[model samples]
Target: MRRRRFVAAVLAGAGGTAALPNTAGSAAARPDSPARHATGHWQPRAPLPVGRGEVGTAALAGRLFVVGGTVQEGEASPLWASTAVHSYDPRRDRWSVHAPLPKPLTHVGVAASGGRLYAFGGFTDAVHLNPQPDAYAYDPRQDHWHRLPDMPTALGSIAVAAVHGRLHLIGGRDSHRIVTPHGSPVSLGFGTVSAHHVYEPGTDTYRQAPPLPGEARDHAGTAVLASRIHVVGGRVEDVGDNLTRHDVFDTRTQRWLRAAPLPAARSAGAAVVMNGCVIYAGGECRPGSSTDTFDDVTLYDPHLDRWKNLTALPGSRHGFGAAHLNGQAYFAGGSPTCGGGTSTDTFTLSLHH
Candidate 1:
């Protein structure tokens, strides 16, 4: 009966996870992730209270928080690992269940400077084996969540961004993941990292930068225009490979540049910017195929650096929880099909171009 209601909503810890699969080759120069049309005006809100994937998203003020992930998998998988915490309030199109997360994580590295909400390092259960350097700090006006200061090593699929006010933790997959052979789930190899850190929340500190260019990635997706910090599309060297390779980073010349790739080639999607362009919505375009996710949505015109394939994600899924607030571009929970399935389906994108 629907995987027994996804194992009773994953053993009643409720609030999800599951949708891991990537590894695809043969499409060469990108651009082939399912394709449809019209997502150009987007607007369909109020849905997430459940249905999750490698979730982790942030945005303060106008609300849009959703953390941890893994709703369920197979082979006696046991709901993977989820520690729910939801929020969404685009001017009353509500959804709430906040305060949760001091444990259970899944490829975590969320961000929301100044107004609090920061939880880094993840994977405390399988799916790449344990790797958690606990770091938390949420305080939506005293809804509470503390514990910061951990993360000098021990990471998980990171790629968080906040810039200027600190909080830039690029590249990911450290402390090991992806080791198959003999017990073979069939992933010949693993381990990826290029370590780049910069936390600094008024002194919880972390400082190390400049080291991701030769190759090393994990669910990559980042955004912050002009002032630099792009890093797009991920999964390179055996996860089934996926990288159109477009890196930027330039917090005043910490250096690293090259853009205009990705006509199709995505990984762990949802790198927002909204209104002014530069987006990469709904991930996992190809890479060892997770039974087929990637419902396309690519647009980037950072003044013509080009890339366009607007709309497609009313279906096809992956570990969802993209960000951008106030002006739109929110895409909560995830997994419509592919690797695993989960969804609370909340969508909103307002860019009338």
Candidate 2:
């Protein structure tokens, strides 16, 4: 995440994890190390062909797919929201530009299911004002992209998780509709919606489910651990008012439970779990903090209900996406600045522990 426009996420069913090649040091190799025991190190990988932020990335069929987002061609080129889909093959150390989306969509929620890639609601472009209702599916085996039925409500920047055989979409925002007496945008902000939607792949249709509790929130991190979906660290009503509130939704009981809060409250981060620890990394922090974008990483062991700060990112960024492969975590395509400019470079965190 480039700390660029913050967003939330969800992973359902058995999400795929990429296996990383051995590049980082092992504890046995560092016998005198106290630091290695504290947190792992970050490794670099081949860069994305195009630099983008606020994009969608998901792993399907053994490859990582980077979906729509805002792309910066350069200082001279105009910033544009993108439909470009790029994929990375860790085994080949190579990248390929895949079929672009049918439309340019930024701030999209993406996931993989039924051996295909699914993209949910998104902003029409990086302008971030117009929300889209389109839902689509990409079949790599056929090199094809097709439209699925639109969401019951058009919302963008939501968290999606695949549980069992269904996709769970939670907490996103529609374009702000209310204005004030002075014609100013409402101060409370038009940031989040407390809606929960479920997509059934078998039916190619969507159904309503339970909404998130309390005030609406966006830009949270979501993951399925021990069979429950955990939503954490998002803005309550606006981008700057980030939260550390953690909510866990039980897929079986169809209810939510309060869980351990994030050590740092942030928006626009990526959440990934490996080896029993759910890691929340990157995103925007304070409004004017010198390093507004976060590079620091935190790991939460659900079994223990504790959080530990790991190694900081090689650099801070937000609006990116994360995937795990070969016992390591990979973050790709985000802006270096908390506000703008995208990076084509890819960074990896080695989970040696």
Candidate 3:
């Protein structure tokens, strides 16, 4: 099925919301602003063996890992969840396959801590349906994944980050349980959630944290710096209802603070902390006939509490993977346009310069 048709099918059951306009008062420098743009250059890297999108990406023990995601056979093909796991070695400039997820999934939340890779809730079916609460931890030494405790709430498109040796699972969306006329519990209806949970690997326990402030959302860009977790733009209730809200959580005081909003509203963008700044790249907006993907690369300076534009991505894309490894930021896979097309393209930008 085409991307538009698939989205329409899901929306018919999930319902829709009024699209929010991008904030004009964001602290981010405008496109034609006189502010100086950050200097950086993107270079091509080895491509993935298969094209995919909505991948969970993280850096572990000097290697970058791309986990479960949506894969397309062709432009006219229907999308499906993948269980494949691939890792890239910056030193070797090559990609290697590893033990796959126990079940196919997409839009998974992933993070690396304590020398191990952890994956959280994600969608088990296509078009963001059937959210799961399953969790797993990967041991790189043995190239194996061990099932962990399920999250308190089942969801997909969640933003996850590790802080002080614990995994913080933030905003996402979940299927709304509604019994059908046939007595089936499988409903495509869904809603965004502000649920937040902290998982402790040592005790294998989870504690409820403060819910995200403002509206519930999914596919928000996230980064951790100085014991604070920054949550950027995301979709409010539907993919097309994107937001420019930026919220920061200070772990020390256990409080939430507001930060500069993104210059443009985006969801499913790749975000990573590099060189003391939060770098967010490529996201999607306005699905369907006027579908659009963002190519703008922007950086947030925590010290200045402001954002500035960096060099734009080579092309528009979303649902890709990004991680900062050895002074360079690596991005891989994702749909080149809005909706379902996938790409094998991978690239890197050095932070040393």
Regions of model 3 farther than 4 Å from truth: 1-37, 73-79, 177-189, 286-289
Give a tens-digit lDDT track for model 1, residues 1-353.
Answer: 01100001001121222221122322343334222122466767878755677888988867888888776433344465577788888889988887788788886988887888888888776454577777888999998899889988887778888876788887776644354455545332246676788889888799988766646777888888656778887775333466777777778867776666787776777778875567787776455454566778887755446677875767767678777887678888777654445677888776653
Quote the positional error of residue 132 for candidate 2 in Å. Answer: 0.8
Q: Write the residue-wise lDDT of candidate 2 on 1-353 in tens digits.
A: 22223343323222232222122345465454433344777888899877788878777877778898888765655355678899888888788988889988888898887788989988874345577888998999888899999998887888888788788999887857432325533222255787899999899888887778755777788777766788888776445568887777888877777667888778888887667567888887656563568877888765445577888888888888887777677789886665445788787788664
Measured by lDDT, the strongest candidate is 3
Q: What is the C-alpha lDDT of each candidate?
A: 0.70, 0.74, 0.80
TM-score of each: 0.30, 0.84, 0.85
Count of steric clashes across candidates, in order: 14, 22, 0
How many Å off is the CA of 82 in candidate 3? 1.1
Q: Please state the error at residue 334 of candidate 2 in Å.
A: 1.1
Model 1 segments beyond 4 Å from truth?
A: 1-33, 36-41, 44-63, 66-86, 89-92, 95-134, 137-143, 153-158, 161-168, 171-194, 197-210, 214-220, 223-230, 233-307, 311-353
Between prediction 1 and prediction 2, which has the larger lDDT? 2
Give stretches of model 2 more than 4 Å off. 1-38, 178-189
**Model 2 residue 127 CA deviation in Å:** 4.1
